[model samples]
Target: MSHGVKKRKLDKNAQESLYFDSYSDVTIHEEMIADRVRTSTYRAAILRNAEAIRGRVVLDVGAGTGVLSVFCAQAGAGRVYAVEACSIAEQAVKIVKQNQMEDRIEVIRGTVETIDLPESVDVIVSEWMGYALLHESMLGSVLFARDKWLKPGGLILPCRAELYVAPVSDPVVEERLNFWCTVRDQYGVDMSCMSDFAKRCILSGDIAVTPVTVEDVLSHPARIAELDLRSVTAEQLRSVRGEFACECFGSSAVNALCVWFTVTFPCEDNKTLVLSTSPFKPETHWKQAVLYLDEPTDVMQDTKVAGEIHMYPSEDSARHICIHVDYTIGEHKKHSKTFSIPDGYSEAQQ
Candidate 1:
C-alpha cells in the first residue's frame, strides 16, 4: 500500500477500536431470541426469582425484543413500562400485544435516559449486560431512569455487580512485541518502513493486549470493580483506573486488557437474579470487543507494574454510552474505546 493509504488504515483501526471497545457481543433482537437471548444464564437468574415483580409497577429499560418486558408482565406486574431504542422497540410493541399484555404493558419508543413515564415504578426490570456486562453500558441509562421515576424503595434488577480481572495464558503478546522491535530496526534503514511496522503492530501479539472481557483473562477472576445498580451513575463510570503489580509471564506481552463485570438483582423470596449467568438473558450481537493497545509491554509473572483503564460514556445521545480505556502497563501503554454518541451536537441535529 502507498504511504498515505497505510496511514489511513492505521487511523481507521484506532477509530474502530474506540467505537467497538465497549460494545457487548450479545444480540437480544428478534434474530437473537431463542438462540441467544432466551437461553442466557443472565435471564435464567431473573425468571428463577420472580417474586419481586408480582403486582408491581415495573419499568423495563432497553426493552429489546420485548423479552424481559414481556416476562415482567407475565410475572404479574401491575404495569410494565417497556422502554426501548432502535427499531426493535417496534418489535417490543408487537410482543406486548402478542402476549396479550397491551393493557398492562406500555411500550415507550425512546431511550431510557429521556423517555417519559406516567408513574413512579415499584421495580426496574432490565437486561443491560453487554459483553462483560457493560459494553453497551446500558446500566447508566437504567440508573438515570431509576433516579427519575423509580420509587425510593423500588427494586432494581441486577442489584449488585462486580468486575473481575486475572492473569491468563496467552501467546499473542510475544509475537506483537517482536514485530514492533523489527519495525524499529527497519526504520533505521528506511524512514518509509514506518507503515509496515504500524500494520504489523496491529496484527502481532504473542500475549494478548486487546480489551477482552475480564472473564476471558483468568480462569477465576479477581474482582476489580464492584458496583451497586441502584446508585451507580454515568459520571462515576467515566474512568476505571487501577494499578497492577504482577509478572507478565515473559511469554505474555500484555498487548491489551480484558475487563468484565456482573450484575445481580434481588427477586422474590430473597432469591437473586443475574444477567451474566442466566439461562434466560438479553442479547447483544456484538462479541466482547478487544481494544488494541496503542503500545505493548513485556514482563514476567509476579512482575510489579501499575495500570489504569477507562470507559467513557459519550455525552451525546439520550442513550449514548461510549468508552475510552487507557492502560499504562509498566512504562508502556495501550487504550481502546467505544464512542458513546458524539457529544456537543446542536439541538436541531440531536
Candidate 2:
C-alpha cells in the first residue's frame, strides 16, 4: 500500500476506536441499564412482539452488554446473535452465561458490517438511538445489518422513529448570560462586558445535551424527520432534513430549539409500543439536545417560528453529528446557524 492510503486508514480507525473505546467503560453501561424508561420499553416491545421473535433467528446490532439479546431469548427466540464492537462484549458474554442463556445467545465482538452471521435474521433489535436521535449515527449500522442479514419480511424492533423540535425558553441560558453581570457585585470586578463573549461561547454552534422541563417549552413541537427503518437508506441517513412551523403558546423569548425523538415497535393487532425521550415525557439518560440561538427571538402569542433543520454527519468523523437551522420568527428576517456535537463528547455514552 501507499503512504497516503495508510494515513487515511489510520485516521478512520482512530475515529472509530475513540467511539468504541468509550463503551468499554462500566459507567456508560450502568447508565443505560438504569434507564428504566429505555430498558423497560424494549423489554415490553420484545415481549409484545413475541410471535415475530419466537422460534426465529434474531440479531442485536450494537448489542451493548447483550441486554437486548437476553430479552430476545426470553421472548423465545430460537437463536440470538449479539454483535458488539467494544470491549464491553466480554462482559456481555459473562452476562449471558450468568443468566444461563449462553446456549441461546451468542455474543460476537465486532461491527455488524464486518461480522458474518450464520443465518439470516427474522428480527433485528437494537438500542441505536443517540442524543437528538442521530448524534452518534449508530442507526447506520442497524441499516447495514438489516440490508445484509435480515430475511425477507423480517421485522425490526422500534421499526419507526420520529424526530421533533420545539422552541424553548431556557432559563439556564438566561442564568448563564446573567452571571457575568453578577461578577461585579460579588467579586468587585466589572466583568459584565464578558456577557457578549459568553453568549457567543454558549451559542457558537455547539449543541447542548441538557435536561429541559415542560414549563420551559414555549410552543408545541413539530415533527422534523421520520425514519421507517425498513425502507430508510444509508444515503438518506447522510442528511435527514425537514421543515417545521410552530406557533408560540404565549408571548415569550425563544432562546433555543430543543430536539428529541420517539421510536415505535409494532405489536400484535396493530398495537404499537413507543419509547420517547422528550421533555414532555419522563426523563431519560438521553436528555434533550438544545441549540441555543445566538440571538434570542422575542415573540407574541400565536407567532409562528418556521424553519428548516438539516442533520448530518460531520465531515471529520461520520459518528459526529452536525445540525443546521434556517429559521424566521414571525415576519422577522431569515436567520441561519449551524451547530454540532462538541468534539471529544461521545453521543454513544448518552
Best by TM-score: 2
Measured with C-alpha atoms, the lDDT of residue 212 in candidate 1 is 41
lDDT for residue 300 in candidate 2, whole number 0-100: 93
Candidate 1 lDDT, tens digit per residue, 257-295?
Answer: 444455666756665654443212233342233444444
**Cα-based RMSD of the predictions, in order?**
8.3, 4.1
Error at 115, model 2, angstroms: 1.2
Model 1 has an lDDT value of: 0.56
Residues forming the 10-long window of minimal summed lDDT in candidate 1: 341-350
**Global lDDT of each candidate:** 0.56, 0.91
Please give the distance, in angstroms, between residue 288's alpha carbon in candidate 2 and its true position after superposition: 0.6
lDDT of 2 at 118: 78
